[model samples]
Target chain A: MSELLIATHGLTKVYRGGVTAVDHVDLEVRAGDVYGFLGANGSGKTTTVRMLLGLVLATEGGIELFGEAMPKAGASVLPRVGALVEGPGAYPHLSGRANLTLLDSTDGRRRRGDRRRRVGEVLEQVGLDPADRRPVRTYSLGMRQRLGLASALLRRPPLLVLDEPTNGLDPQGIREMRELLLSLNRAGTTIFLSSHLLAEIEQMSSRVGVLDRGRLVLQEDLATLQAPTGLVRVRTPDLSTALRLLDGQVVDRGEGHLVVRSPDAAALNAHLVARDVRVTELGPERRSLEEIVLAASESA
Target chain B: MIRVELVKLLTRPRTWITILALNALPTLVAVLLAVTDLGPRPGTGPPFLSAVLTDGTLFPLAALGIVLPLFLPVAVAVVGGDAIAGEVQSDTLRYLLVRPVSRLRLLVAKLVSVVVFVVLAVLAVAVVAYVEGRLLLGDAPATGVVSVSGSTLTQAEMTQRTGLAFVYVVLAMLGVAAIALFFSTLTDSAVGAALGTIGVLVASTVLLGLDAADAIKPYLMTRHWLAFVDLFRDPIRWGDVVDGVLTQLGYLVVFAGAAWANFATKDVNR
Candidate 1:
């Protein structure tokens, strides 16, 4: 991966009425790496993204983009960064082509042939047909997502920040978006994707950061974080006593059940037997990305 | 792609539609009035048409006396008042800001578009009213029916009066539109901005009506709203016209300056 493309230290945002949505978040995203920012709704992921793009004012701290300190948005830095902060921002009354024309003209990158050519390229990249000139309001949710993606790709920006780009997409559209993002990353563009869907992030991102309640709990590569490990669920006659004995080794699974992870099952059974807890059911549990994420979230 | 900011401006179809209706209504009403014989004829004057249209009385009703003072500026406000705040409500403002454009440029583009719409709407009202007046009342000589109070001017004088009235109305309308645009910056609800603008205009008009408050009337925006009234008198007074232009210009500068500052600094999270 290239050097750090984005770095922030002590970033914070406090809304009115004393709600501290984002609390002193520090993040580092390297160039050409697909970094997934994971968090549930209202967990400060969106707030941090907004601060980085200068859409919302940061309460405190420093942000550096591509090696330069960013006290505020600057012309030198912003033009090279493309983002879809929330959702589709295009005009509903204008056709998809007209929307692209407006964005292209603002940057003074104009040429009749270039406009048509670039629009075609971006439409193809986003899986939208350039020949269709219907207003964006008529597009489906997935199509709007594609249109937004096309807008972001118009400039072929080096740093692309997309928040929930695959939101509301069908399985096919989601797969296409995943592939498109990977292709963009392969071409040396750093991708910063914020989403609540860990499965999608697990499939696409090189690294993932888990945020819970306005705080970062863990930041690790997807491969390292998803290492397969067996989870052992043993049902006993006495649930309360089993949990008491294996205090630090148990994840609360409500309704008088506990999930314990261990490599040796025989040894676990012997220990439980010694405590007079009957093991009714003992089996190896498969650990999926969803379980791991849930465990991490529950632990946080 | 046209700039995202401009696209945002055009997305609200209701804004311009409201402006179109507001501008067209005054002319429509005037035309309807011209064709009808609602009021009594003066001194059994040859029918209502000869007294009102042919004698040039339609000039005051069409341009200065009523249409410009009440309707034109209010129409301008109806559109310009919702320019900024409407975006906040629709949540599209966030999308535009995320694009590479600065807040200042975005505000400038949106403000210019709103001003352009207001100007165009005002002009439409003026043209339609003028053409309709001329067609309905062409060349017929004035009879003794309509009250040509001693205060009434000659036919030629009335035509000049109408022309000057149009200029003053334009100036007053410009001031109203600027105020409305400023209020739009202060709020997120389109209704709040539009109603607040109209309410302020109405309040100023009421302020001008108070006999005891005459001293403060000269400084009020509403008092100067009828500065076009000066155009109706003989030997047209350029002093009120100049003061009216300068005052409207001053208000425009202040309102526009505040809008720029607020939009540039305010957080557009939407």
Candidate 2:
């Protein structure tokens, strides 16, 4: 297995009013892995990322980046990491290129040509025109997002953390982002991303963690999380009586449909028919990530 | 590190425009006084030049008061204001913090940049004032400091006094710069940093002005801010300048430390 590039052990955070913003969350992200952090609004995803970055102090817990303790890791760990948090905050009054040029190696020693060349490369990678000199304020939301990504890529760090990277992108922009992330991972960069968009997570992530009410409700490989939950949707003439007669646990009993968790579909059908309920159809329900996540959160 | 900050500073048009306007304001005042022939006759030494220089120092010092009240603080605010708050507001603090750089380095880089600008503004004022003083008062030097206690100095002493007076004024401005910088750490909005700095300065000035109110006078930063004017005295009472520099240093250290501590502890998530 690849090394765990980023890890958080029993992380907890409490804001003013003793609100548990994050509570005892354990997260492990492996190198070269695209880890998807999925959570609803107010689920502590951002809080977790902030802790990992050392932007905010953790109330209790430790975080490790590349096997070294953080944020005590200091400048030693950050040099190898790049991130785009919350929104794409660029210097609105500055040109796109100017924004990217604001941070560099601290010793005032820079190969000017190399810096310029790298900036051009990242801009092109993000699909921004290399020569575009317009102030960032003039750029559209998608363009600004691209500029932000360009800034993150400037130093070519090994690990990249992005929060809601697709928050303000069109369909084409989203596709480009997905492809770009895949390419980055292939190039040996580990990516940890958080998003409320489940479909996007499903499409990009190798592993996923779901946070709910400041707790990690679920963490699993993408394949397992996306696997068919084996929920059977049943439509019967007498839904209420049919649900009562069914051997499986009833998940949903509505006007014309019923959903149940059961492997023995044939046994369920036979039992339902014997109860004078005419079964119209019965098949496995294809659960979307949205449904599974909501169920997990509710259960937690 | 300086280059990165310089690039950031130079790229923003507002930086140049602000410096330009500030430099020009005094020149404009000087030109108006010269054109209106608003001074003592040439052989008699221009009353207008002395009045102009004293108040030029005072007005710009007042403008310095305003600028410190707003401009330097705004500048300091922009630096400290954006220090972490800007990152938080822009959501880029995460990216910057995650990099190999420490919070202290980042804060130091920003503070250094603001100091550079403050230095720039002070130098610009000194140069413009020199040119205006020369043009309005002629190449000859003014008399010694007109002592509040009624004493006079020779011409040679007067020249030294004027030069030293300008230096003290710049030093006094540094006190204002430090205050603005300290306030900048408290807010993200440049406006908040600027306005808060000015508000504090105006209050300090008020406290300093209250003659009989002995309680708060000694502690106020404004109390000794004008002591640079004492450089004009014939004997050059080093006491006031020494006291002023020491007070300014004390405030710089105290305010700067307070800002750093608050910033180091502030949740960047804000």
Candidate 3:
């Protein structure tokens, strides 16, 4: 088992007006895992991220990052973790390069001489032009998003916590961002990504956790959640003949397809073909991430 | 962190614009005094105003007097009030905190930046006023400046006292900065914090004029603000000057501590 990079035990948060933003959620993310955090609007994903980063104080329970208690060991632990919460924020009058340099200067451990170089490197890493001198106020939303990612990657941190990282990006920019994140993950950076876009999470996440109305409704590996359902889906012109041959094994029927309660799709296809039934398509039925999340939320 | 904060303060265009606005009033006063030669009746207007018509060297003091009561304090309140709250408003406070900058260090850096701004504004006013006084107003007599006590003060003595007054003015403005900073940490709106600090100063000024508030008058934040005038007296009246310094320091310690205590534990949801 890989070491747990982030662990929260019975974590909860209650606002001053008695609104529970995050209920008892025990989240665990191991090293090298691309953990996708999923939730609807106002489902406490951002609040939980803030707590993990020590921006918001937790009302109950505890959080441990890299094996040390958080918001207490934050001074030491945070330097190793990079984050972009909500969206990009920069001084409106400063160029993106200048903003990154200023933010880098806040960390005393970074050498002064290396700041400019590091800032340039991160800007290029995020597909931004380091020579662009326009103030951030004039930047397009996609440019600002890239700048935000550049800032988070400035120090080459071991972990990245990004909320809606791909927001405000065009299709091309989103694909670029996805590729960049995948490359970074392959290079050994743990990522905790929070978004409402299931497709984004489905494409990249190794493990997934879904939050619904202040509760962790689901937490499982993506592969496990998307595993085959021990049923076969067949599409054919001879639907009646296939159904008669399969008889009681047919669980569901559509216009030109049938869902058969069989574990082996190929064997079912062979049985139908030997009986003079032409099979157009045959495959095992499996759930998508969306279906799993919807079921989990409904059950919760 | 202090260096970074100072860099931020110095690089901002608003800082320079505010200092320019601060020097405007004093410069206008100098130009008007030079053109019309109508100085306020002795002791009736800003301290040393009537005297500056005769000795240009004394215009720095006159300029300080002109802006000390309202303009300088307002500028200080705006800058200090924006210290923390502006970060919150701009959404940069969380990024800074997660940079692993400790809360106490960030607060200290913010206070230092505000102090630097106060010093810069005060210095700019004094320097600009000196040039304006020399070029546009009467030249000082070869003998020396006449003290507030109607005694002659040597040039060296006058320079020393002017420097002392500059330091005192900076210290006085620090009291305002501390209060504004304390209020800044309490709200996410920079404008609201600035207005709240101004409100406190206005209340203090109102109570200072009321006889019914006499018992607490000595401790009022603005009560000792103009006591720097005593720095130019013949024998140098130290009573009010000392009290003023101590009072401003008292305000600084109390309000800065309050700001730190409140901000260190803030939820920072913004």
Candidate 4:
């Protein structure tokens, strides 16, 4: 029901050597959605991101950002969109502040006087020291990654397209980045995050799109993909008694547990308890994001 | 966008280092001439090398001649070649493009930056040579500079002609910049682009010496590089000067057009 901030109509890209990096992907990201684009390495995720940003021209089909035809209207539309593709890039010889200042200057729409304030704000927002005088070359990988994010956030655009945003980050840094992104999303910034990391997409994305071998193998809401199956997993101390009691309904047997073809976990547990079976752990069966993605990849 | 590029160029250490290297040869020559008090006999060396012994003001022209053949063009090639390819190498080109800087604007800014570098190098060489000539070489003869045609040149005429020669040398280097920039767009390696430009210049020089290549000699990129020397002749000959301008402009148009055609539609996968 919300507005679609990004929509691609059968977009595709084929390199000169006949390599189809992306094939007929109709990506749709609505407003206020944390769209997680999942793919394995070399599965055309980067190519799709590049096409969306107008860095790589699509060989066929079309792209629209904020409802305007993309690439053709990139000059006007891109100013409202921020992105970090592949990795962060900056002038190594320049200080972080200087690099951001120059990059910010590229957007002619921003007033010159407000640049320093904006740069400082983004640096602090990314947990970086705005006063750090060291050149970017001296910064650690994490610092450079943060700087890249800062550049993307400089304009406070309504949309952020970040590819592998948590890359090169230690656990603490990743946590901070996730928190920052979530806060931004809460403040009404739509996020299109692309990564091969399932755990990341699983945690933050409201909607998910999976790319496999240059094809959009699956696109659905994270909740839909992760919804409970019509089954219940039960761990019992008396495994034999539970198995005998639910012989025909038992679908899968694992280490110390049984998956029963029952929709209500409480009812299944009650039935087992009524038979004098000791139920240790019982819950509704739901596929993990990893399992879902793997299933999609296999089918594709 | 042009302003941003110029800021990048001016802030870069490589730019200053190249400029300093360019001035080194001319400065060293000035010191040697001052110490030994020996000048190659008139008409035997780079355009005004011998003339500088008695008239220091002419050293600027001599300095231009010293670097014009190789050093100046090499510097231009390096800077121009690095224009687009260097960004690609560092992974910044995509960021800039996605910053929504139009491909045309970026290309124009790069071309302008290269032109600024050419102008800066030529001007630096002339200024450094002027000081060295004043302090370490001779003052202008009281009768003023002796024109190449064995005629007297007033102070005003000498200064005016030197300025003209300066502009001409800058124009010549612009042709080199255009070539290097075109190559820059074709590859992501800055060194490759620079070397390719130098390779073309070297080939032009090699062919210029072979009578068998005479038919195309007049159109070679380096063909009229020395035409500025004629600016010193009394009642200056405009024939070669005009041809040199036209030839350089032709190269600029053809090569810059080729670079734009390739780059504007490039996939920018890097």
Per-candidate TM equals 0.80, 0.82, 0.98, 0.97
Off by over 4 Å in 2: A105-113, A228-286, B40-92, B134-163
**Model 1 lDDT per residue over B86-189, tens place:** 66664456655665566777666766676666555556656655566666544455532222333656667765655666656666666676777778878888
Better of 3 and 4 by TM-score: 3
Q: What is the interface RMSD of each candidate, in Å?
A: 3.0, 2.6, 0.7, 0.8
Question: How well is each residue in A148-260 modelled by candidate 1, as lDDT tens digits?
Answer: 88888888899998999998789999998998889888988899999988788888888888788887777777777665455677777688898888888886465656688
Candidate 4 residue-wise lDDT, A1-87, digit = tens: 889999999999999999998999999999999999999999999999999999889999999999999899998899889899998
Q: Can you list the residue pairs that collide in candidate 2?
A: A75-B100, A78-B99, A78-B100, A79-B99, A79-B100, B39-B48, B40-B46, B40-B47, B67-B71, B69-B198
Worst 10 residues of 2 chain A by lDDT: A102-111
Best by TM-score: 3
CA RMSD of all predictions: 7.2, 6.0, 1.1, 1.4
Evaluated at residue B52, the lDDT of candidate 2 is: 49
Winner by TM-score between candidate 3 and candidate 1? 3
Candidate 3 — which residues are off by over 4 angstroms?
none
Residue A243 lDDT in candidate 1: 86
Tell me how each candidate scores on DockQ against the true complex: 0.27, 0.42, 0.84, 0.79
Q: Sort the predicted structures by TM-score, highest score first.
A: 3, 4, 2, 1
- Residue A28: error of model 3 in Å? 0.4
Q: Which one is best on lDDT?
A: 3
Question: Model 2: what TM-score?
Answer: 0.82
For candidate 4, give the lDDT of residue A279: 88
Model 3, B151-234: lDDT tens digits are 989989999999999999999987899999999999999999999999999999999999999999999999999999999898
Please give, for residues A1-300, the per-residue lDDT of candidate 3 as tens digits. 789999999999999999999999999999999999999989999999999999999999899999999989998899889999999888888899989999999887778998889988998899887544789889999999999999999989999999999999999999999999999999999999999999999999999999999899999999888888999899999999988888999999999999999988888888999999998888999898889999999999
